[model samples]
Target: MRRQVLFVGLICVTFLVNAQEEKTIDLDEVTIQASSIIRKKDRQLIFPSKDQVRRSMDGLDLTRRMSLPRLWVDPNTKSISMANGNVQLRINGVLASSLEVAALSPEDIKRVEYHDNPGLRYGEGVDIVLDYITIKRTSGGNLGVDLSHQLNTFWRADYIYGKYNRGRSEFSLSSFANGHRYKEAWQDRTEIFHTPDGTFQRTQEGISGRDYEMYWTTTANYNYTKDDDYFLNAKLNFYYYDYPHNYSSALLRNSESKMTTDLIDNNKSLNTRPSLDLYYFRKLPRKQSLAVNVVGTYSNTDSRHTYREELESIPLTDIYTKVDGKRYYPLVIGIPCAM
Candidate 1:
């Protein structure tokens, strides 16, 4: 009996050893390599790879490919936003417009400097800054066009950009236009209002008339840069917007004895803005610099609205309003000093 018990104990030990061996695992080593990012105290410098530049269509596309943290890029709107605040885009320390960014060539980009903490030099309310450094171009030119439209809706947008560089100067022109028109819009809603006279309920139904909008902007810019020692830029911009027809008519029924009334509202507006900008920069000794900016702008707006209520095609109430305003700044100058 003792021999039998010892044999059984040995068998159990062998089974346990086999189970432990089956549960054991062997792992392979893994190594992680850093990407093209340089970390600094207050900012980070990023370099785009050859592959990234080759696939990118423009500066905006390259920025999206970089996948910078907390930065959002919308291709449809051609806008960039950051978390908690707005993002400031600059080219070699100079503020850049959307058109300038769109006209940039990925091949000309050298490096990007990102700053999350800005000093007093940037002024107040400056949250983040992205500075794009570009390589010197002896002579070159680029032309591009962007178009977007909805599949089933009457919405369309187009942008055309062209730039030419020679020696130490560059010229660029860009235009953006978009339009929308709604053929048929129907509204069915119930509204309840409490007035001084009494509480009333309104039920509106039927077709809301055609609505249309149009907008366009054009910019012309000239820039001169001589080895970073001297810089000058001049830009002119013109913008126009028109909303000539926004008419809505509906059959409104009131709670008072189920009375029916025809409601119609019409609104239209026109706006125009023209602006000119000039900037100059010079490098001074002892790590100091001189910068000057000048701007002139004018804006005008004209709006008109009409409202009417009719019973059995007879007008019961009619109201109309018109507003016109214009403003202009002949000259505005600013100088910034850095040490």
Candidate 2:
């Protein structure tokens, strides 16, 4: 028995020694980089750093600096767009306008939420949505101005905004304008006619033209808010657009006829629009909320167009048309709440 026990112990010691002789293998180093974007199931949240907020002039400027993926920010229009599509803007779940965006204080922003695919709650045709979550301030104000001009062109965009908050009440006023008034514009196009007869092609070569286009909007806002409770906002907007002159003179040459014609086209349009918006929001228990929005608007418009064509000094075609119209939009109400 002693002999057998000694033999087993020797075998166990040999197995233990082999187990202790296991080798260690070194692995290649891996680097993991963190991104600023936080993706959720249905949305992406972007948190702006202190440096980003400090350098931004206003809410619109902050958004422009974010360089959001697949979204284009246009400073001239104070708008955000995607490829051939529009993105809806909101402030803390409430619909926001350009005036509100201009009046926003960059310091108050907490995070930006982007929804690439909207659910049915947002209604049809609503693909993209941007929601700006903000921290409520009891008192303070903001003033901002944005101006851009092209050195070689006569186009300019101007915006001015002011806001003041006292206690739980806030007031803001903002105005934005974009337009160009110049006589040295250019336009070129190719026209094709497909009929039972042989196809005809006309290519227009423009030398010089005149353009006058302007769009202006101003808004006054009053808001009441209580942190973690409820809020009410009332806004009045006045919008105007004028394109008094858009004249283009070009040489139209027919590829088949081997003929050239002098063509001049002119267009003019004017619009006056006024709108009112009312919004209310209340927070509920169990992380629920209720919101209501109402909007009403009225518009008046005038438009005119004229076309003149001549082979020589004499006119071959002269066409003119004018239209004037007025419209009133009834109150539009929306309620999006969670229980």
Candidate 3:
């Protein structure tokens, strides 16, 4: 009886790569030695389809959901960066991270499976060194509310909200209010060349473009499962970054004649990016599925740089006595003249 079943199975897979040659994978060599597990699954594992899975899961009302810790992925990549330990990632004729993967709905997902373990069947041939999770794919999220004060240098507040389902969904939102005090400055140095006759011929000046930054993120999400009944999977995220700076100092020529007094300058800039994601999934029985996901993002940034310098002469001390002058203008120096 067993030989007859095997013969039929072989016929189904007759398109073997090396048909002309014969090779056999010894059962002992193919076995993983985990006898207890092999026996346990053959007798208990269940591959439930949608109708059956929903029926089983619906047992728990919407009031409460099951929670299982699973790896979280970047969504776009089939890469799982985290795992809850057991690492059940693959099986005979089955693969993990397949496009038709069953997701209950962002809201129904009780737990996600994430196994970076090289021991995973899918990674048995992968090098052991490249198997760790990334910061973005970590499997932990929580909620918290914070109060902030911006009346001083170290004043700020934050709030957090997060959640994830075992089968289909995840969500989170966070915001921060802040106030900061800062001081920044710029410096310029110049060298001039002159002949034995004195005066000047050319100049070389160095200007440093510099600044400081501060910002925060405010965002939210609502992802749906890989189920057909749930047509839309949605997501949204936003962030705003800000920077304010102040600088001083610019070279005054005949520099030897100037006291090189101090100067003050100020500038401010802001940047923001907003993005939204939506997708659709359709499943066909016989283990086939298709999905279409779309993403939209927009970003805007503005910058302002202000710089100026002041020069004051020291007592007539004959030094640079040949020249003396104070420059007080919008300090706007337009394009330089070649001559």
Candidate 4:
């Protein structure tokens, strides 16, 4: 009986110890699973997440990371470009310019994706695409200025502001202005021959006294998200430009006697453009999404030219031309894909 009691107690103790060990193992597994879940939430491939790339660099830094041989940045404009053509930049899947990218800070970015082979929807000659996914911050802003001087002068200033709420709503506004002045000179020679008339030659020398330009642009964007499944974005843009040029030309013709013509030309032009874009996105199960975009643009141009000429020291004639035009463009695109 004593030996049986001792054996029973040993069996009970072993059972209790085994149960405790199993419980501890289960707790450890739960903790590991929770940590893995957290890690998964912190890292995402398609969108901006708390990753090394995002935490360490800004949008411009990300662009430099491409290390493409053909990629280059314009110091004067502070814009990035590829050798083939302009680099397509998209912010949250909406068309954006390099200036917009420069305005973004690292904290504002969620992810940067470089696409060498863009989808057919992106059109032809699109060798590269840089897409920026942005995070929703409570409030943020950026300011930038670029200045260059040589024979001509160039300068630009820009500002951007953004606001976001925990309820999945975001708003941003950006504005930029630039000015330029250029000087140019050229010479032209022409020879004329006729069956009945003798051959003659003409030489013309001209200089653009002044070439001035000014440009301004403003953009406003709004985004709304519902349950991480449906998203809507709206953007409005306005642009304006003014350009003026002055020219003086001296001409000599080898006729019976040397004939001289003095000319003055003046040209002024103005352009205005306004655009609106609407984007919609719907997320489906299994990590798929559908997107639709609509864009509308309206542009207006006004130009005027004045020309005055004197032939052989005599007043010849004066000409004036004025033109005004308007254009409208509408575009729509839809894409559905799995992530």
Per-model TM-score on C-alpha atoms: 0.78, 0.79, 0.38, 0.66
Q: Where does the lowest 10-residue lDDT sum fall in candidate 3?
A: 10-19
- lDDT accuracy of residue 292 in candidate 1: 84
Model 4 per-residue lDDT tens digits across residues 1-339: 001111111111100000001112344534322221112232223433345354433355555553444678653354788766657888866778765675566556655666666766677778777777776544334433333333223433333333334446766565666675544433455656554656655555554355567878877878887766888989898989998664445454555556667877778899999999999999978999999989999999999998877876677888999999999999998888886
How far does residue 302 in candidate 4 sit from its true spot (Å)? 0.6
Please report the TM-score between candidate 2 and the true structure.
Answer: 0.79
Clashing pairs in 4: 48-110
**Clash count of each predicted structure:** 0, 0, 22, 1
Q: All models: lDDT?
A: 0.78, 0.78, 0.37, 0.62
Model 2 C-alpha lDDT per residue in residues 1-339, reported as the tens digit of each score? 001111111111100000111245776796545566899999999988778898876788898898887787776588777896667888877777755775687777889998988887666787788899986665666666666666655566777788777778878788888887675666788989998987988899886766778999998988898885888989898999999988788899998877789998989999999999898888878878877778888999999999999997789999999999999886765564676
Q: Give candidate 1's error at residue 54 in angstroms.
A: 1.5
**Residue 132, candidate 2: C-alpha displacement in angstroms:** 0.8
Residue runs of model 1 more than 4 Å from their true location after superposition: 1-35, 82-84, 117-126, 148-154, 186-188, 194-200, 312-317
> Per-residue error at 264 for model 1, in Å?
1.7
C-alpha lDDT of residue 236 in model 4: 92
lDDT of 3: 0.37
How far does residue 242 in candidate 1 sit from its true spot (Å)? Answer: 1.6
